[model samples]
Target: MTVSGKTRHRFRCRYTSMPSPTSSLSSSYRNPGGSVSSSSLYHHASYLRRGKLVLGIMDFKWTLVFVITLLNLQPSSANGNGTVERKVHVGFIVDTQSWMGKIVDSCISMALSDLYLRNNHYRTKLVVHTRDFHGDPFLVLSQALSLLQSVELDALIVAESSGGVKILAGLGSRVKIPIISLFAAAPSLSFSQHPYWIRIGEDESSQAKGIATIVEEFRWRSVIFIYEDNDSAREFLPDLITSFEETDTRIALHIALLTSSTDGDIIDQLKKLMDLHTSVYVVHTSPILASRLFLNAKWLGMIGKEYAWITTSMITNFVNSMDPSVIEAMQGVVRFKPYVPSSKAVRRFEIRWSKNIDGNQNLQEIELNVCMVYGPMI
Candidate 1:
């Protein structure tokens, strides 16, 4: 049958009303497993509603379908005029075995998808190639060099932990490609020194102020600082001490834990802290280390209302995505997280992501930040 949008057509046949056929049409469109095409189903339903079709409502629905089909058939603007769209290759250096690495991977995929879906007019598309560095500086440098030599990358997104930032930043400068970091928030990697590096994660120094505010608001006179023994954590310690000092707060103790620290080391450190009278603690470390500390603290019966545990945003941002048992261990802990404005788009994306992308995991703030930074650039 021919489909036309003639405005003044009428039919003499009567069979049924429009609602039943419209519902059937919708069902058929939703589940199109049957041999009948949507167009045929619509026409048959319209004919069944009335022995002969009328022009008004039926024609309008058909016109809408046709328009949607036409839109779907239209080629992308970037591919017009027989011109090939340039593919911008971007490399990602991450610790694939780690939790932050997974978040970074998911966020990068979502960002690229959103960019193309929203801006179909762009003349370039990003192609991401990922390399895992296992959070080792030497491995990170080797990976960066390999990626630069093997691929014509336009940019590099490094999602390593704190210690590897400088090595990756140096590689970015030597290669003359911008290095974008979504998770590395070391204060030492300054823009003046590493002009090619861009960090999107909230600076630990700024978040230290938030921590100090929480301490002052709670009227805590002194707190024990527990942080990773790395450049990133050390870089923020001075600022945190300064912030606390500004608010008339004192650091009762400072303990640095190495990544290679064993359970005995953690427990021993906790024993030392417990020997003191300090009940207030501020932890600034990677989630892995934070998890270990909290788990050991919970085992030692140190996590309770009497002891106030505060964590920096580095730990807070990914708290929701952490293992539930680990979250339970730090039940009453106060966390300092950067404020992010609520967006319906982000909410919808999160829901979709939880349902389809990673069913077991919730979207984290760092993942959202990564998407926000990379989405616009694409």
Candidate 2:
């Protein structure tokens, strides 16, 4: 099930939704607490559901906010010069409690810290003001307006596919300040029309082509598309579906599970999918939710030689930081890794990011947004 309005119509034009499977698997597995199942998968799913899957980022947010800035922010006055560094007031609106929000907050802070360290001669310093909109569109608009009026914000950063984007884009156009997205925005947010709106990440069309190519190579005739029910997933689906048509692949089923779905709810939906013969499933969700999904699927016998799984870059980018159990459950899954150009500077930034994480992750840095943040600074 997908969302409505123009997007829904566009998606439906290319999709043939598999016969509404078993009415949500009859939702019969719900427990007295609604989700506190005594099963092994439930334990893992619960941990992830609490937003603990991202590990260090959650615990380190406060430290990043308070301690990292102590890396010595520049005062309004430049060192030993009559000229002052222009403090560009930038506003960041996100749900800081969520997985994506935490990363954006930390990445921007680290990226800025790194920026000032090497380029000491830079004339402009970004002074960031963040507001947690708690995933509410109304809050996004309100917080955005507050930041604009209170701080005289020179620019705004928000999730490209967030519900708040349209609202903020309108505001940014009126104010004539840049509205930058944290990651690659989908096709819908055309940059041609709205010059102030900026998207940073892998090109959306290229991402779609990559996903379709993978599926085509694997010869998965009809696959199940499972994604988190969010603005990002909605924005991402149209291009992917179109790409599928070019590859002559059919979407047998597409299930949009809510970001807040509990273990029982998720398991019930997975059970419904089992009724279908389709053995391939494509998942597009955050690492936390996707981890939880895989754990439950493995426990339900969905992870095996008979089945194959593919994940979008959203989940793959952060898989290095996921728990061993979650990673174990994801064994043999295909992932679309976002490509970042290799250079000494990129390598240096990756090393610094690894150290800042207390060595919890040794893999290459996947914070495309970090590179994106550097754009405004230039």
Residue range 122-233, candidate 1, lDDT tens digits: 6565678889987676788788889988987877878765677778888778878778776535656677888887665544555565566545644667889999998778
lDDT against the true structure, per candidate, is 0.63, 0.61
lDDT per residue, candidate 2, 1-378, as tens digits? 111121101000001111233232211122223321113222232232111111111122342343235323534656466777666677888786655565556667787776778788776667788888886767988988889888877668775356668766667778998787655554655656677776544444555555565555445688888989888787778877886888767888889999899999999999999888887788888777998898999899887656667777677767766777887777656566434445787677666656665533433334443333333232
List where candidate 2 sits over 4 angstroms from the true fold. Answer: 1-81, 135-137, 359-378
Clashing pairs in 2: none
> How does each model score on TM-score?
0.71, 0.71
Candidate 1: residue pairs that collide? none
